[model samples]
Target: MGVVAAERIKLTSTRSPWWCAALVIVLGLGIGILMAVLSNDTEATQGTDPFILSATTATGGVSGFGVMIVMIMAALTVTTEYRFGVIRTTFQAIPNRAKVISVKAAVVAVVAAVVVAIAAFGAFFLAKGIAGSGPTIRMGLDEATWRVLYGVVLYAALAAVLAVAVGALLRQTAAAIALVVLWPLVIEQLFLLFGDIGKDIYVWLPFANINHFLSAHGSTTADFHWGPWGGLVYFVVFTAIVFAISLGLVNKRDA
Candidate 1:
């Protein structure tokens, strides 16, 4: 608990977290509003699912841009320690190296969850207001609506944890950030350009699974679709595998 608290303090004492939060809020709301303004009324139809529209708006479309900020935070959490030679001091204060990693992961998970939840809700309501009496108006809380909200929150948290795991594995800030950022932004997109096989495989990617979770409807592509709950499970399992590998590397290596 003390270690977690100290980490939280370190995060708060720095300006980066605040700057990241600002960027998330700005992107969440800015992109959401743009989507709301540009979206056609026809998109509010049954096939589109107005609830999904609002949800997507709140989340800055299906691309998960806000999670990118959280991802940066996650990578920096450990990578920053290495950059500043603070890991040795952290190891000295906490003899159980694994415990230190565990606590840092926990702290990041909790904080990312809260931050993304706020951003999601903020974007949702802002879009709702812009939507007005349009087709994207807020439908009362229903199972699907709630599910989308829950999935968005879960997706953000998982992305952050996955980035943290990657950071732990790589130990270099630039490398970790590059891998996390480029994989989704460039690599995944590039892979999807290889025709049907790429599309089939792309759905299995973390960001794609997250998009599936946010959608009220299932995917049209039979092979790619994993439904909401199934997508969540896939993401959790993928993140767990990454985190497990990171734990193994941390245990075997020097700080």
Candidate 2:
């Protein structure tokens, strides 16, 4: 409990959290508004579902961009400590390696959740407001709407946790940050160029699973779709595995 509280305080004291929050909210709202504007063409909504464009645009704006910053923040939570030689002090203070790591994870998860909630909801409402009385106007919380909003928060928090695990495992700021950011943004998408095998492999990637989880209509696979909730479970398991490996490395290595 004390360790968790200390970690929370430490996290709050850092400038990264504020920067991350600002970026998430600013980019989320900005991009969402842009999407709303672009999607305002009623002719485009001719035969399609009117609400889909608004929902997809608003949701994608935040979840797509906001979570990437959260991943960087998570990685820095540990990597920054390493860079500054603060981990030695932290380890000396906490002693229990796993406990300290768990606390950091909890703190990062909470921060990520809060940031995602604000950014996502702000994007949703801002887009809806800018959309005006048009075909792309969707202003209520339907089942799909709930899924998208909830999915943003869940996906962001999970991504943060995974990044923290990666940071802990790698113990290098630049390498961990690059790996965490590029794996989803570039690598996995590149893998999709291989057709069937790529698609199958994409299903297992965290970022792909996140997209599946947050898809407004619930994404489909060639053979199966675990659905949003199932995708969440899959991501949790994946994060847990990486976290376990990180913890093992932390236990074995000296600070």
> TM-score, each model?
0.88, 0.92
The residue-by-residue lDDT of candidate 1 on 10-91, one tens digit each, is 8888899888878777887787787666554564444744434556555654237778889999899999998898989998
Off by over 4 Å in 2: 42-52, 133-140, 220-225
Assess candidate 2 and give its TM-score to the true structure.
0.92
Model 2, 1-255: lDDT tens digits are 889889888888878799888999899888888777766766665574443454656867678778888999999999989888999998998889999998898889989999889888888888777776654566567987888888789888888889999999988999998998788889988867888988888887877777777777767653336777777788889999999999999999988
lDDT of each: 0.77, 0.83
Pick the TM-score winner. 2
Report the Cα lDDT for candidate 1: 0.77
Off by over 4 Å in 1: 40-52, 61-63, 135-140, 220-222
